[model samples]
Target: MAQYKTPGVYVVEKNAFPNSVVEVATAVPAFIGYTEFSDNKGTSLAQKAWRITSMAEFNAYYGGPPQSKFSINPLPAADPKAPPVTGDFSITDSATKQRTEYELKAEGTSYILYYSMLLFFMNGGGPCYIVSVGHYGDDLDADKISAGIDTLLKEQEPTMVLVPDAVRLSAQDCTTVQTNALMHCGFKMRNRIALLDVYDGYKDRQDPAGDCVGAFREAVGTNFLDFGTAYYPWVNTSIVKEKDIDFTVITNLDVLTDLLKKELSPITDAANPTPAAKVKIDQLNAALAAITSDWTKSQDPATDKQTLNKTLLAVSSLYPQIILAIQKKLNLLPPAAGMAGLYTMVDNTRGVWKAPANISMNGVVSPTVAISNDEQEDLNVTTQGKSINAIRSFIGEGVLVWGARTLDGNSLDWRYVSVRRTMIMIEESLKQACKAYVFEPNTANTWVTIKSMARNFLTSVWKRGGLAGASPDDAFSVFVGLGETMTADDILEGLLKVSILVAVSRPAEFIEITFQQQMQKS
Candidate 1:
């Protein structure tokens, strides 16, 4: 009420309601990894948090995916008793009437962040932040990755942290990155969660080296387990289509050319070569020569690259095999980015309380290693209480996320992912709403207003099925006052304290049915 001047009648507007709590986004993830480029026109987004809503925005600002190169090598001799590694295949030489085994090995450290970004967008991810530590060809340095994680401190919108490139580092280094991420989310930020991927997740649990899940549990340490979740094994995705690959991806062009020539020797060495065979040989030779030739001399490198691709596809039969192998290599990606997208999709469609499990993943062909129910038991519920989620493939369900527990599986308070995330959403939303009263007098009037505002906001969440109760009163409680959450000393020290308690909904991870014989009612 303002003092009236000159005895004139005055009307004062008074707000009857306290400021409402605006729910913070629960799934905008921050991705820290290498990108092709981070140039938004002239400005560089290197090691900075940049928000992008769509893949188009990402490509425009950060360029496109990496050009991963592979080398075709003869498979080394293996003990007959040992099983062959994944991705190993055999090709028969028709002229020699013998079969030869071969494997496609990555030429160098394959930069997977670009491909992982594609996977994230493919799986229904929405707005996210990208922190490019460096360009595509830079080494995967742990210090650089840790620095990138630090960049997110200034950005408050992101609720999850994912470093898809961390899996490319050695086990020790990858664990270091995961540790840093967990610490950042749980200890430093206290408002976000970290989605982690097991190193060498494609390998089976019984791999000769050791159990991948066991190694992850041992190395991930005991701090802030509730703030992170791990998924295994890696998924074989369809993000890299056949059309995206070409002969240029093969680094051993000389060896590939020799192999193609040998394949064509049956027709070339013929005493009386048919006209069709001669034409085929000539076209193949021209394509090979063009590929080997210096492309800098070409007037248009872009068109020349496309023409060379089409020529190789049309003339060489072995070229398809090489391209397929390369595609597979690129498609075997860690599961963190895809999980980040899943979180976003689930949060958007359902509330943040919904468990992101038992849902089939998009752009996923299958899990790299099949896990039977018996095998997943160990992964789902371990002795050390470090639970790792399983991406399992059912007979008709395709590839599905099978588990929903956090790393601290044994703790009933923060066991499920949904419970933890739901709490985070509530805490953050109310925290923002209370900021309006930061310097206001910490008295009974302010306390009542804050409590009413929180109750109203939580009523909405309860209606949305985020809390486990029949009524708003049963779902949550908010306390703030001299005797409740704060004492006289606390108010004297300028501390306005608030305490909240909510019974978050938990997922029905297991259901059992019982059947018994009954007397005929009729």
Candidate 2:
């Protein structure tokens, strides 16, 4: 109210509607891993939570993908009495009739944050946060990844945490990082969930050494199971293309050179060669020798790599095969990033209450390890109650996310991922909307206003099929009066309290059809 000493005609306006609750974002995920670089102009985003909306922004700040290094080595000769030795790839020289078995070993650079980002965006991911713990070639440390998870504590928009590079670490260390992430999401913040990738997820569940899922269950402790979800059998993807990699990825050029020389000897050692043929062969050999020499002499061989790579590709037919092998290795990535993107897609297209399963993943060829129906039964339900989601590929359908349970499979309340996420969304929205009424009067009027605001927000959610009920009253309840939620002493101590209950919708995970034989219908 304002007093007017010399006012001609005072005009006042009264607000008719109460303040509305704006829903907080529910799909933004925070990814923690290594990158090529983390810089914005002159600023460094290393170990910082940087928000990016598109792949372009990520590239501008974090730079492009890191260059991976691989080495092709000849397999050792096998003795006649001993078992035969095998290699990842094999090529036989027709000229010398020498069978050479070679294995491709990725050296130095194996960071996957770049490819994970590509997978996320390809699967409908939107705005996200990137926390670069270190650069490429740096050793993967559990402590560093834990520190990256800690940085998200100050941020409120990230509703999920994903450490895609954790799988590159040892199984024990990866478990340590995942445990920290779950603790941060469930116990500390209580606003997000952790998307975890099982270490050795590329291996089959029934591997001779041990079951990957069982090992994950034993190592990942039982704390905060509801706040985390794990996916098994990493998916094979086409995110890495032929142009993305070249001969430069090979660390040892000597093996490649020897193989190419032996392969080209037939043409060069001909009895009667034309002038043009001889000149072409001589020039090709000189170029190949020069490329190896320059790379060996210089500390950094990437200076003239593009030119040398072009020459190598034109000279040798083996170059494309090696590049393809590298591409295949890079394409086998963990499933956490793809799941995060699917969560975002589900939340955006259908409300957050919808389960993020039975949906095909973009840019995915198939799951590395195919899981049968019987195998998935053990994964979906266990005596220990550690549930792992599965990604399966069908003949007609490309690849789909199959299961939707959290790590705590037996909990009736928090078993489903959609239910847990919807609760978080509702809780966070109301918490933020109530901040405006913090210091207001603690009376019937204030109570009514707060209750109306919450009911309106929940009514909107219920209408969107987020809550399961016949009507608004049946869907949710909000109470804030003195007798209902607070006592006289609580009011006297300047404390205001409110209680809310919502019947969040649950997914029909299993549907059974009953059949009966009918007789004599005329």
Candidate 3:
């Protein structure tokens, strides 16, 4: 028996070169030894010992060799690029003109294409198919079919590639499958038809050289079809549709742009080269010179005198206008009357005033003694002596009589009411005056309290009939009482007290009575 060189069984002929044969025997299956078989299998036979020619002859004779007990690490699975599958299909028979709809189920390798198809659909790709063929008994047949499909793909340069579905065994069963696979590969397939010729042309001794041409043309036509209705406005683009707004009210774009540029120019210019502050010292100096010259010329005795008189008359005539201007500038004015009058008097006096004299009599005179200027005037019967007597009578009678009358006509009533009212007025006015003085000097309510007290006191006395039908002595006493209450060491206070006393006393003789006597001795 002759052993085979390869590790497969083979048949051997016992004949020599001419034809001398004895018995026909099968060759022993040789083992091809490697690292995996080194331990159990002995050293390999020499290459010179075998004369194996073909794998076919070897397998034909010794194909039932003992299987090697060795471990094999299976190869990593290939990431096959399977196309997509269709879920359902509607088929129309051209001859019968009948339509049938069927739901397609995916299996085996077809499921992979279906999954890819689903992913494509999710990613905005269109639908496609799986073109499958029936079961091939061996890998050789599968290789042949795969090679034929690869050749067709390369020659036609189709947008999509198709492969057999492992579960579907017939081309008719997988028609929609092929359509779906193409769609999932981003190929649009509609309006045009695809015909798949599945006959094994090579095995059957027929040529398939031009078979895919029509199918390729159909695919190209489908791909380039003008299905204008399929193009939707909202799909495949990100442009935002906007509604119209009335823009007439807004400034023009060019105008706004120009304005913006103008505005920004200042800032940019400022950022680069800063501008210096403008100096007006020279102008101010010129103005000052003119003002000083005018003022000096106006101050001349002859010129100033006339100018002063003119200015004073002008001011008097336009006093309201001047006051309005002043108020606009200063927002206030001094009180016009009342306390202002009292303050003006105090200001004029410069803190001092003459007081009225108090009159008193020793005793009343008897009835008339006549005076004669012609007769050598007796000292007792002269006009001067009678005048003195009359004066004494007036003081004596007036004080007692008017004082009694005032007492009778509720004198204490006015006194109490006046005192209380005056006190309240003084308190309120003092607070107001103090606040006004603090906030606004010109508007200060100066001497308000003192003025109020003096006015109230005099009014009270006058109302009590002390000023009416009263003797000088009675008037003097009333004035003295008012002066005593209103008197203060302060200039304003002194002026207020004096003003009221002058009004109250109605003095015939202006006597400079001492204010120290009138003031409270403390």
Candidate 4:
């Protein structure tokens, strides 16, 4: 209302159209893992959520990939019949007085965040958030994972949740973390997807129907399978390189070998060395050369020391590449992070309803387990509805993501990942759009405006092939009014209710055709 005392004429503008509903993005994933560092321009971000838009940004903040992990703790039994470690060398164990046999394995903490992010962005992942629970060398147990998950609760932008290091936790602890993740995505956020990875043992198992999948199912429980998805047979990646492991951490093998030999028995102008002693000396010298080439100059001021370091002190470094190659081969990454990357790729190229399956995965060398169609039958269409998607490598197609069902495999409504994601997109969009009419008068005009807004949004989705219907009416229906969606008492109670029914499009999981001999008549 304007005051008449002003004695002036004024032209006032008013909004002519109702508020429009804008579809929310459904691809941003928040990965929880370990990186080389967690600092942003000298500011510590450990155990905190940080936004990274590009690889350079992530590198500048969190640093690059750390070295692969390896150790020789689990040694083999000593052979009494075999010749002793003679002539030049002696071995010592921390626990026992002396050690005889050593078995080197990549069993230390894996600094996978940098490489996982590399894979994610390489496979078409876009701007996303990272909840770095800790840096390399930090223990990532169930408590740390759960704490990492809690950081995402305040973030509304992330539509997908992934814990790439879930395999590192103990079985019971992993179950606790995953259960909490399901709760966050399903009951708490309701707008995000939980991409989980099976236990590491599933990657190399000879049997698919036995304890592997059974262990996973028992741990994940049955409550909110619809909110999350599990991927099977971890992916063997080439992302790790020998150069990534800082070689400098190893001691000079030749010098140590000579010192041990001299301590055993002084050789002053003694006879020629035995063949076994010569072999040991040669092995030591070669390992020392490798360390001198890579590790000795690693401390130079010009060298970038962001990469991590690993040591296999107990084993022979005669051919370090053999051990390093084994480490790379054993670097079986869980599928959650990769799936997040695929989710973003598919949602961008095709709409959310388009299943992210039968598509080749970038940055993957091969699937750890070769899954045939018969093996995938139980995985894709399981009776328990605990669908585990498979990653299989075909001859020409490369390693492709083959399945697209959600954890709720048997449900008609929320079976496929696309259907679940599509509904989330729509639901979030409509909920945000309705915020504009929160305290507006509850009248026919308001009801009509809200209904029109929702209908326009759904109609656009249908036009873009997100919904299934021959007409907009058949595609979706929006009801909001005095008699349609709410009663007189509901209005008095300050309740503005709207009932929306939509025909969500489902993926063609199975495409079959009927053929008959009569067709020859045509």
Give the TM-scores of the predictions, in the order they appear: 0.95, 0.92, 0.12, 0.82
Tens digits of lDDT, candidate 1, 360-455:
899999999998999889888877999999999998779999999999999999999899999899988988988899899989999999999999
Best by lDDT: 2
Candidate 3 ranges beyond 4 A from true positions = 1-386, 390-446, 468-498, 501-522
For residues 102-153, write the lDDT of model 2, one tens digit per residue: 8899887579999999999999999999999999878888899999999998
Stretches off by above 4 angstroms in model 2 are: 1-13, 77-86, 93-98, 266-287, 295-315
lDDT of 3 at 307: 46
Which candidate do you rate higher for lDDT, 2 or 4?
2
lDDT by residue for model 3 over 388-490, one digit each (tens)? 1011123234211001010011222221211222222323333333342232222113344434444454344445433433543344232222344444343
lDDT agreement of model 4 with the native? 0.76
Compared with the true structure, model 3 gives a TM-score of: 0.12
Q: What is the C-alpha lDDT of each candidate?
A: 0.89, 0.90, 0.25, 0.76
Clashing pairs in 2: none
Ranking by lDDT: 2, 1, 4, 3
For residue 435, model 4's alpha carbon misses the true position, in angstroms, by: 0.9
* Candidate 4 C-alpha lDDT tens digits along 108-222: 6755667678778878888899888887877777788789999998888899888877777777887888899999999989999888888764445456546677788878998
TM-score of 1: 0.95
